[model samples]
Target: METTQNTFEQFKLNRQLLNAIEEAGYTTPTPIQEQAIPLALAGQDILGIAQTGTGKTAAYALPLLMRIKYAQGQHARALIMAPTRELAMQISEAIIQLSKYTDIRTVVLFGGVGPKSQIEAIRDGVDIIVATPGRFMDLYFREEVTVKHLNVMILDEADKMMDMGFMPQIRKLLEIIPVKRQNMLFSATFSEKVERLSHEFLEFPTRIEVTPQATTAEMVSQTLYELPNFHTKMNLLSHLLRDEEVFNRVLIFTRSREVAGLVHQYLLGRVVREDALRVIHANKGQNTRTNAMEAFREGSVRVMVATDVVSRGIDITEVSHVINFDVPLMYEDYVHRIGRTGRANHVGQAITFMTFADEYHIRKIEKMIRMEIPRTKLPAEIEMMETPRNEMQDMLREIDNQKRKEDPTFLGAFHEKKAYRPPSKFNQKDSRARRGASSRTKKR
Candidate 1:
């Protein structure tokens, strides 16, 4: 089907919503939005399979808002469940912007924060709710929310939700929600879990798969580098940045937050402009992640290092390049990481730095995706032995130590709150044994 000249006009969106979209600088609808919006507005269950950074949020948020605003009902009409706190907040933000014309209220609930405010927000009555499964369950268990009057239900990032061990929570939530409702399952990939969930939740939903399950974005120029284990990735990264043409907006994906911090420190010392480089990850907290993303979006940051946790639900336009500093263990992650660069039909580049140890993961990714990624030569040290797979844990620990040395505030964020440390059941017996052993040693 041909895309409409103006999706806003074609959908006959309310003037206020259209005006908000225009102000947000979105006139034409993205592919997923173009197809899913009409079906959603028609009160049809939809199974939308599209890649990340494809504007799928708006695809569901827009029509859901329109329907909620026009239709009459109460009892939390719409419930949108996202896999992570970041994604829940993002979806809620989109919904709020789209629902500005009407009196529709959206409440967002997620973990890692106080629940009092969220409870009050729900108590006050909201037309829509976007939440992470864990916090949402907390609210439900407290009897702060009900779904008997729910009109629509949305499962965003369905596959990631399963990966994050949210299937049980989702199943429980499903039981509470009214059976008669419009269901929408939007996922980046159609894995077996997604298909199973769709079969169970949706009732003859209209299926829309915009891209192949393991397909990377077509606009992304993907390449790989066969770097040796001993080669300094920092020097090679600096070499790439020296080109001057690749500056402005570049993202580097690493396997851990510690690695991300190390890369950020390395870039900070050499980039000449500290303001143009930053790091983001799950351990950074919401505020820091939000700030880092905003800086990158405003063109204030030339390079942003991130972990996979921060890779989901992050939408930034005009990202010139995405560099995989470490190969992703999962095949779908390879798709989302590269999807960040090439967005909205703009051409972008993705380069992966691979060591010999990464050969297994690279092969797995290739086999799963059914395509070989083209390889390029490394900077130097071609004869170096691969880092033993068993030594990867030690490498990670060493990286953590290096990050602490470089970043003074490395552990400060985590220090403010104490993690759970359960007491040992044998503490009394162990203490007695230690005292007896000390007395015996003194006699000796």
Candidate 2:
């Protein structure tokens, strides 16, 4: 099937959208955009399955903006629900840019900040709302936001929303919103949960899949390094970042906030300049995360250490490398993480550092991607560090848990061992005395 739109003009988008597209330097439509824009413009529900960084935003945003050509009402006509605040903001920005020539007004609603401004924005006027489910519901319950006019609903990163356990809120939203609405659902990978969601959310949707599910981007060259411990991984990361020219504009993804912080601290003033390094995770204030992301996008930050919070949210075009400091347990995220670098058809590199505990997840990720990650030998200059005893035990326990998950009866090496033993003399004497007392009482 041909999924390429040679030019934006071919879609017959309004002159305003075309101008914005030209200003945004979008010469040709991406695969998802090519397939979804026409269907969306035709007022059909859309189920878009494409890897991240494939211009999925524009695939839906352009048609959405066209549908809402001008802001006429006080209430929003379109609602776009993203999984994270960062994504909500990104989507809002994209829409704002696309709708610049029009009178469309977009407001982003998210937690971690006061709702006063969001409420004020909605009260003043908004044609489109880009929000997370919780924040949208909060404002809706408070009667601050009205959804009676919502005729278009979009669920961006639907898989991530499901993973974040936003189903109940989404279901509630569905019940409250007008049933007569156009729906569009986009995801990097369509898992079973997301599939179920599609059945509930979409009505006779036109499914558009630009790539295979969970497949990494073709422009990204993936490499894996099997290390012995966290310390070694850190050392290897430092060594790789030392090459300033090649590793410029890198995004380092860790599985947890603690690991992200550790990696940020490890590289500060050593391998990366203090001013050129930034770290972002859930614990960071919303403003702090926004600033870090902006810096990384603007080329002021050489390296950014972050958790998966921004994996599917961030949309930067010049990222040179994406380093997986820890293999993602949610295997689908591997595609999103690597998709960050190889964007806009630019060549990018995805390097992963896997410890023993992470090997199982790496294998699963490989299976999902349907390709084995080529292993690279660690540089000899970097000395291997010894794994801490506690760290080693944790890895072993994790491995055991993985094994037990696979085999119910498999006892781990750490499982306690109980052997048969005779009772001690003290215990034996106490037992005899207790038996004699009981016999005397019975005779009496």
Model 1 off-target regions past 4 Å? 1-6, 70-75, 379-444
Best by TM-score: 2
In model 2, pairs of residues that clash are none
Question: What are the per-residue Cα lDDT tens digits for candidate 1 across 1-444?
Answer: 975685688998788789889877897788788899999999999999988888899999888888876434445888999988778887888877777767888899998778998888887878898999999999889888887888799999898898878999999988888899999999988989889999989999999988778788889888997654423466578778766576558889999888888788777867636877888877776777777778888888788888887667777879999899999876688888888888878899999987545766788788877889998765442223333445544544444454576686686323446432213421124444655676698899
Tell me, what's the RMSD of every candidate?
A: 14.1, 13.0
On a 0 to 100 scale, what is the lDDT of residue 65 in model 1?
A: 82
Model 2's alpha-carbon lDDT is: 0.89
lDDT tens readout by residue for model 2, 1-444: 865449998899999999999998889888888899999999999999987788899999999998998988799999999999999999999999998899999999999988888898888999999999999999999999989899999999999999999999999999999999999999988899999999999999999998989888889999988777788788788889999999999999998998888888989998899999999999999999999999989999999999999999689999999999889889888898998988877999999987767877988998999999999876755546655778877887897899999998998866666431222411224434655676798899
| Candidate 2 local lDDT, residue 19 | 97
TM-score of each model, in listed order: 0.81, 0.92
Give the Cα-based TM-score of candidate 2 against the true structure: 0.92
